[model samples]
Target: MQAVILAGGKGKRLAPYTTILPKPLMPIDDMPILEIVLLQLKKHGFTNIVLAVGHLAGLIQAYCGDGSRWGLNITYSMENEPLGTAGPLSLIDGLEENFLVMNGDLLTNIDYSDLMKLHLEKNALATVSMYNKDVPISLGVLNLDDSGNIIDYIEKPTLTYKVSMGIYILNRKILDHIEKGKYLDFPVLIKQLIEENEKVVGYDFTGYWMDIGRHEDYSKVLEEFNSIRDELL
Candidate 1:
């Protein structure tokens, strides 16, 4: 199977640390987060990998040269300018009929093979890996009816939403919706697909997952890594 890791982001949210190293290169425990991602993909039987790189691309290329160390065939797709999220897919060549795409800064134990299996089983143009996230509201939320009448109130309630995990399985045909040399985020691309009545689906995952792009999340990973290291690696 083939996989494309989006490792090009400037990671402005991660400032000073990202000022020195790209988000994918940021260390987790013993190695960079991107290394862990590669290991997981390889374990799931994805040998052909393409790293869509920019923003300190040289460092990533040097550190992961050829991917021979991990018994994977790794290639690069350099972005001279920012390509948002899905735009970089246009820059990559020779993508398989269906391939996996994901952000490189994530730490998760998701089964990539299973994700692909679901995509194939459903014959979907795109499959988004989803996680149900519970967001707590500190203040009360109100429901209003027509004419601005307050209908119901829930005090400091929690809301659950199925959210994209920045991981996806996309068929080659889906690329037709994306234009080359343009900035297109994933959300806009998905919306366009829906507007066109393309077959897009979601794979719900209830496993351990975290995006360590913020300082607080990074700190949480540091605190919890040792406990979940076995599950992740």
Candidate 2:
């Protein structure tokens, strides 16, 4: 199977570190996050990989030359301008079947084989990997009626949502929704699919997953990596 990893983002949220290296190259222990992702994919039998790169593309290419160390083949898709998330797919070639597309900075224990199995079984146009996230409200919350009277009140309640893990298994036909050189994001593409009555499945994963897009997440993953290294590798 083939995989496309979106590693082009400037990662402004992780500024100081990203100033030197791309977010995908940021170390989680001694290994770059993307290296971990590649090793995991290689373990799962994905040999052909495409790295979508922009900011500091040279450094990434230098670090992961040919993917020979992991026994995988890698190709680079250069983005001259920011193409959002989904737009980069339009620039790649030979995606005739279903492929896995994910953000490069992810740290997760998701089984790629299981995700592909579900995608095939459902015959979905796109299968999104979802993670349950609980966001806590630090302040008091209130519910109001139509007349603006408070019907209920609560304090520091946590809201749970099945959020995108920034991972997807998409059929090649999904590429039709993306325009060449357009800044199309995943949410917009998914919304377009929904409006067009396309089947978009969400596979709920309760395993460990983190985006590692921020400084705090980087630190958290660094602290957690050792314990989960065996599982992720």
TM-score against truth, every candidate: 0.97, 0.98
Clash-forming residue pairs, model 2: none
lDDT of 2 by residue, 1-233 (tens): 99999999999999988998999999889889999999999888788999999999999999999899889999999999999999999999987599999999999999998999999999999999999999999999999999999999999999999999999999999888999989999999999999999999999999999988988888899899999999998
Per-residue alpha-carbon lDDT of candidate 1 for residues 1-233, written as tens digits (9 for 90 to 100): 99999999999989999987999999988999999999999999999999999999999999999999999999999999999999999988899999999999999999999999999999999999999999999999999998999999999999999999999999999779899979999999999999999999999999999998899998998889999999987
Root-mean-square deviation per candidate: 1.0, 0.9
Q: Candidate 2: lDDT of 160?
A: 100
| Backbone clashes in model 1, listed as residue pairs | none
Q: How displaced is residue 102 in candidate 1, in Å?
A: 0.3
Weakest ten-residue segment in model 1 by summed lDDT: 173-182
lDDT of 2: 0.94
Q: Which ten residues in a row have the lowest lDDT in candidate 2?
A: 39-48
What TM-score does prediction 2 earn? 0.98
Error of 2 at 74 (Å): 0.5
What lDDT is reached at residue 164 by model 2?
96
After superposing candidate 1 on the true structure, give the runs of residues whose Cα lies further than 4 Å from its correct spot. none
lDDT at 80, model 2: 99
